[model samples]
Target: MNLFSDIRTLVIDNLNAMVAEGALPDGLGFDNVTVEPPRDPLHGDMATNAAMVLAKPSGKKPRDIAEALADKLAQDPRVSTAEVAGPGFLNLRLDTSVWQTLPSAILGAGASYGQSDMGAGKQVNVEYVSANPTGPLHVGHTRGAVFGDALASLLDYAGYDVTREYYINDGGAQVDVLARSVYLRYLEAHGQAVAFEDGTYPGDYLIPVGEALMAEVGDAYVDQPESVWLAEVRSFATDAMMQLIREDLALLGVEMDVFFSEKSLYGTGLIEAAIDSLRDKNLIYRGVLEPPKGKKPEDWEPREQTLFKSTAHGDDVDRPIMKSDGSWTYFAPDIAYHYDKVQRGYDLLIDVFGADHGGYVKRMKAAVSALSDGKTPLDIKLTQLVKLYKNGEPFKMSKRAGTFVTLRDVVDQVGPDVTRFVMLTRKNDAPLDFDFDKVLEQSKDNPVFYVQYANARVNSVLRKAREAGIDVDDATLASVDLSGMTHDTELAVARKLAEWPRLIQIAARTNEPHRVAFYLYELASDLHTLWNRGNDVPELRFLQEGNTAASQAKIALARAVSVVISSGLGILGVTPVEEMR
Candidate 1:
């Protein structure tokens, strides 16, 4: 079903045949041979770099190999023409029938047409939006959440067993700060005036948590000392914050398969075990870290502490696992978390972090590398910041979160589908602008609307065709004789359809979900362009009066386009609108 892979196989097979014919050297590696869309469409439907890659290795001129290969490829029925282009690149133009047959192939596969086995059932754990469990998620966390969810779905579609995970950062001192914040609110609820210290949370979101705490204990801890209430309140406040976090994620239609508690790593021998694994490899040591480059933090006093030789595994510097105060550092809990992931038998680990967490990427990768002894690879994807705007001006922050917009603020403004799609309009590592006015605008400028419009328009075609006494259901249209779809515009849509399987493999292999968004936009654009062309050429219209046969063929093409759009949107966690509202 993968047309590109199919062409690659053909190229490889012919290379073997060339070996048998003694036209090329024996046992030449074909791994370098790749069949991809030409950089310029006018070059050909596809191009290969086989001759160029093999020229130096075979001690033969690339043009000579390309010329011979072109002659042999032209003999294949699917290959209409083949020519050796500049520098031994071979460009191929496929037969019209080859493109025409793609719609039927897509119909046969339904939504599973572009599914790939590249992942080969590898187990992948994706951790994302693991923001501190002290407040609701914000726009920064939203980008990471959407990116991670889409990536997990992409890997799943590519045949990897993926587990969505959220690391609750509940064991840190920040949760203690949250407890104090909630206690202040609790005092406020009991009609006692309280002031928020600079380090304590001052968001109104904690007001509800305070009220609930007051309701639960009924002033039992109202006048108690810090030792008696701090522990109990800290645990209660963390659970409340996590509840808020979960609700925020749900607003964006995200659900995690695992919620790992950072506290679980403590008092469970997990942290010691993770450090012990590194110690066995002589990676753990006690040493004073060098003064950080440039402006170091004010607390940068050089003190000997337990450290991990992270530099050995490709970090900027060795990282500390325990502070000088005999307590595990923040990095210590993280190491244990990933070590647990390694112990869970996952073949791969992926962490989708906020752009601000870019500093942690190298150290985390180093930890996973050391813990797994380079056997398992960890990929850390940092989603760049998302800037919010409305009415062409930078959107201001929510008073509740104080300095940033919360995730729910976005979902409530535009539904989750809009939020998720707009967040992915750019590369994960590139900054994005989420404008409420722009994204919700009913124009081509909004990708979600354009893609959904294409699907809805396809459904309209089906409705009109069926009303005209033509059976337009998938089962009926798929059986229609689609050979009449020979116009260049009609065939162009089919050509895009042919790229579906190939596009999936590329995006999946690169682990880039943004490619899927780009592909869907291009596919929708092609369909829309064809529609605009039909406005002038009545014969090209999808529906023809008293000509159900031709209409069915055109409608079948539209249905195939819808199939690809819907499948791509499914990967993006967006529902394809069946009818435009």
Candidate 2:
């Protein structure tokens, strides 16, 4: 029930007919043709660039092509008018009945009204919030988590086979620091005073992990040296931190399909295998890199290191994969991780990284490009910082996380739904100012509340209709005669409803789930506008005086708005409220 797609098909069919009748030249490529809403709604319902794109190719003036195309489109039953405007663009107005019947389509599709098959069931791997397994997830990781989860849901709605993944950075020195930190807490649990050093984690979140360790081992390693307990405590602490992370994510309604440990890549020959695969392709070599641009030559010393020829795959320069000491560099494990993803048969891979990882993007893409032989495409989306404010002042760090605001802190302050919605109100790469005071307000400025209120209003209409003894079930309302729904205000909402499927494809294609949030806001605005119009025009109200059939038709339109709102909110992983609380 994609009305825009249906209308576009009509335009294409008429163009093909023109070609067949020799009204236009044969073999004209129609791939570049596009049908989209006009920039100014007063011009027409939709606009197309068919004439402009085909003018040079057909050796004809754009206005001539547009005029000819307009005549053919005007003959279609769906197209009430087609007029050429501004040299070449063709503006189209559809029959009123076409918009009038959209409620039936929305009722028929229900929550699947805007679902798309654009992804064609392609396998996509989305890795996000791969925060180090050392402590609770902070506000920065929260943004990535929300963005990644919404994107996965968006792709799923668009018919992609999506797998949510998390890469645990447990094999690094940070985890060792976490182990020593936990050792201090464990000694405290055993009634010994301990001090946290500069390099050790001092957050109270680790206190429970240490107490749990004391319970498990029963002071077996209390007086032991590092060699006797480092490995055991490191493994134990990592598992505890991961458990804490899981709880944090659960608070925000996020669940990962896979948790890949960096430790698993080590001691398994996986890192060597990934590097060897590149070496076999002449990508890996031993070389001396040029001195970094900002540093003086005398301050730099060139050393032979193992490198990957990342420049061949669009990176700024070749990147080192192994150090001069023969130990695998940080990039080596990441390469192996992506190599594993490629071997798993994913058609696409998306990584949600923090803004600080901007420099890592090109090299990571190069690694996947080389590993997959340029078959699998990789997209990295970076989430920027979030500044939190409460009572018009900067929110301070949590005592639990010590130096940062944990994901749980946000979720606990506001519920998961508000946290998720506010996080996605801006683009992924744009910094967001989260004002706790403003987000919970009942005003229209709060997009989440406004959208939810729209859904609630729809339910209110349904309840009032039932109380009036009108059978306002979906089937009854969908079957009602909507021929009387010709008001410009009412039709404006229907026009927005017709754009839902089109919006889904655009957002999915661009890999931007924030577009969904923005669209939902606009849709809610349209719904709210119509609701307010009813206050002045009695005829515009959803319920008519003792006119059951007419009331059913108007109520159907309101229900359709809720249907689409529910579907969009579902994609954002937010539960659409049936009643405002």
Candidate 3:
């Protein structure tokens, strides 16, 4: 149960009662009313802006309304004190029993404690890690992959029907370049020395693909013309590269529900259909474009071309859909791809791209808006660069990837759990520094290890209780009498646990999964704070000697923290370790 929501409903009901008693005017909209933790905890447990939001509309003084509302609120058993703060802010102190019941509620819900129905089962298509299928995924792609996968999982927990998708960039000219590069490898496999000249891939990852091609058709395409082998090799090379990409994703626990091929949009009526849909709306036109702002008239090349009126749908300017050579521009296939997504009946679309793709956000949003007539909402998240370091110095690049570090390079060094958690330690748009030495350090400064250590501590508590012959299973602890759990430090941790469900809704609404990692760190801090206090105060310890009831009451709180941490880490796609090694 969400304690914050429960208290908000309590506040609203008291306001309604005040209206009925003629203490305030009728028909005041309570939509703007909010109940949240006070800015200063010294003021109260929770604060509400009910009087301030209702004053102007009701034609009453905020203080007068707050006084009347406070009286009605005081009648509730959950609220212990309702005091009017500066300018009619109502600060509330809840009864100890309210926070005391939270541990039981958390244990009862288990891992589903923070799951929300905020999305209401709306279908959401999340497209991420759509890197070119030319080689294994690099470190840049890993950030998008982790962010998108975690977002999909987060939305699912918030009750959205999420589809994890990857749009393959296999239909572009890059695939032709990949085919030529593999052809050179094929020659090398045939005992011929070859040079990887300009504009060709020389990574050793393609060596096996070249050998496989030779084995499939022995000496058939040997020394053949470009036309004879380009198409066949392009198809084969992309398939092999996609296999490599899939294996790389698996290393990080990511699996897509769909792998959409951009090639399918060509040689078919799909592109024409998408463009025609725009044409029917008068958004397509043949017009001359203006020169760029900084370009001189003499240096400009302006021509009449087929353009999409993207400006009408919030883009900066109209974009050309066809080039002067009469071939589709790069943006044409993208429009068709998103149009196909809209046609699939998804209510929402989310694209995760590297920071380099920030310029494409507005145009892609405009395309989806025009295609769906503003019926579908699209959100594009750009993951910024990750700077790698070891021992406080820049890390070395992967020899296998040729130019950059591969996803496997990071995962192999720290395992998937550390890599995933550290990637999300910063906001998606903010640059992240992934320090190898610091992340693995078993200290409070390392959030991943600190959070994992909290869970491990809870497990240790349960094991010790079980060995002491005290029943510490979830059901038994959930039913334990927690009236003795009224200490200030114990209640502090409970207050953090109560914020879980609310935090889930906020993060899901804003499409920010990084907030989950942030919340877990705070919760872990609260837990560790209480755990440390036990050393000084004998009764504060979770395992009370010779008293089963008291020990169960205290251990229940530790178990509750573990439950919430597990739930949060599950959304982040990180497995919570039972014990930190």
Q: Which candidate wins on TM-score?
A: 2
Q: Candidate 1 residues 48-162, lDDT tens each?
A: 9999998998889999999999999999999999999988999999998887778877887889989999899999999999999888899999989999999999999999999
Q: Taking the tens digit of each residue's C-alpha lDDT, what string does model 3 give over 1-581?
A: 88889899999988888889888788789999999889999998999999999999999999998988898888899999999988999999999999999999999999889888888999999999999999999888999999999999999999999999999998899999999999988988999999988888888888899999999877778899999999999999999999999999999999999999999999898999999999999999999989988999999987899999999999998999998999999999999999999999999999999999988999999999999999999999999999999988998988777778889999988999999999999999999999989999999999999999999999998888888889999999999999999899999999999999999988999999999999999999999999999999999999999999999999999999999999989999999988767
Could you tell which candidate, 1 or 2, scores higher by lDDT? 2
lDDT of 2 by residue, 435-462 (tens): 8889999999999999999999999999
TM-score of each: 0.98, 0.99, 0.98
Q: Residue 315, candidate 1: how far off, in angstroms?
A: 1.6
Candidate 3, lDDT over the whole model: 0.93
How much RMSD separates candidate 2 from the native structure?
0.9
Model 1, C-alpha of 438: deviation from truth (Å): 1.0
lDDT of each: 0.90, 0.93, 0.93
